[model samples]
Target: MNFETPSVSLNTSPENESHDEQFVNNDTLEFKYKVLSYYNEGKSINQCAKYFNIDRRIISRWKKVESQIFQTKIKRKRCAVKSIIDRSHFPILETQLYSWINEKRHQGICLSIILIKLQAINMFNTIYKNTPESSLEFKASNGWFGNFCYRKNLVLRRITTSGRDLPKNSVEIIKQFFSENCQYTKHEFFKDWQHG
Candidate 1:
């Protein structure tokens, strides 16, 4: 009754872009950076806020976020200081993606990160088509793919299906066994087994 589970390798290589860099040049983040930069360069916060037609409190918050933005820009690339999850992902989309992945695996398909990401993008497009949001960008970046794998306890690698070693002719043996059994009734097969 004992069994074993096959081991799988996790994809640890860095993607084309750092996860932090995924948010680079985000309009809102860049706007905040510009606002803070202008403020630092002799413009008042109020003036920057008025110029952007945004609230002063938001400006103040961005001011507090200035250091984080600077650090992000310096360390890697421009990134949002405050993570806005509004467009990060759609939960239902991800759930459907997970199911799709499982279905593919069940069909003995080995899916890679690139394939999964592409599938995610395709699913997103298909599901949201005809809606205003369809035009919105959905990169299905490696970060999101990795997060999806992590959440679903899935790995992005070749599926390894192994079991206790059997004789090399196991397939033929199985076929012969089934063929023999098909020619016999239950009573005769078990009567022979009882003798064996």
Candidate 2:
């Protein structure tokens, strides 16, 4: 049996009447320029996002990154540097945090404990406030910390079937649920379980 292969011709211009879609409209280019200009004028990405009804992140990428690469400089300030993760502090913070994690592990405390302890020590809110990816809001005795961890990919999430809170021994229950349903070990619970 013989099979015919599909060929793509790069030599022929799509605009040269050689392709099915041969028209490049000027309006599209004009609209793009307008969007870029709005972005260049120090408008918040959210503002441009609302104007276009697109995701703020998309507008941010276009304004701070994509636009800089593609468009001419237009009397605009450079994109403001957002508060960033300080790696120098990570070694110190991670050591302290993991030490606390170990202590909590011995007590059969959950990962939620680390978050709570951090907040109690006044470290979570102060030191990590400037960290871009750390949104450590303390809702003690609530599972918001777990959801935050799941969102940040610090741990995989087992889909919660209901709005109801998991029972006591939630970690073990969650671990068991994942073991039966998914093939991966829940590493987020590993240190606690190991110490316990």
Candidate 3:
């Protein structure tokens, strides 16, 4: 079963599409066999991928499966696992916001607003930690907090699941939280408001 069939030669005019389909259908198994043969012949995966028009990873996988099936005992490549910092660090914050929104459900608090508030606080904490001590002490307006809130709000509005018109009561709760935390009115700050 041959795998590396020579590239089909065409002379000028539109090539036959049906012929291409037929070749693929008829030659897939043979092609797989040939690909394995090429691997055994010491051709690098890059060379095979270039010749085969398939991803090199797929070729590597094929080699593994073939080796396993044939009892070749060739060890498969180790799949590397990467560690990332899980952002589930703010369960307390999430719970607080959830409670606030639940309490304000009548004032029209929606998941959209909840997500915005959480992201805003998260970004604020990040900026607050990173800002210079001189600027912090001088109280110079770097606009970091405003930008953080604006960007966080935009991202929340853009990337979140579709928002619902929050409960009429939740609106009041949202307004109250903003008032208590930053003395900013929802209407004065967020333009995406309607009289519900």
Best by lDDT: 1
Tens digit of lDDT per residue, candidate 2, span 1-196?
Answer: 7686647566554554433232233124343455567877987677766565456765554555454345544444333322233333234444455565567667975554455545534645555677863654543233544543333334433444658776889999877877775643578457556887
Candidate 3, residue 54: how far the Cα is off, in Å = 1.2
Q: Report the C-alpha lDDT of model 1 over 1-196, residue by residue, as the tens digit.
A: 6576535435433552364355344346566677788889998878876555567887787777677766665443444465433343577788898899899989988787778888889999998888877878999877877777766678677647757889999999999998968877889888988999
Candidate 2 segments whose C-alpha is farther than 4 A from its true place = 1-62, 65-138, 141-143, 156-196
Reference-based TM-score of each model: 0.36, 0.21, 0.24
> Which RMSD values do the candidates have, in order?
22.5, 22.9, 19.2
Pick out the ten consecutive residues of candidate 1 with the lowest summed lDDT: 8-17
Model 3 CA deviation exceeding 4 Å by range: 1-27, 68-196
Query: Any idea what lDDT model 1 has?
Result: 0.73
Better of 1 and 3 by lDDT: 1
Error of 1 at 167 (Å): 25
Clashing pairs in 1: none
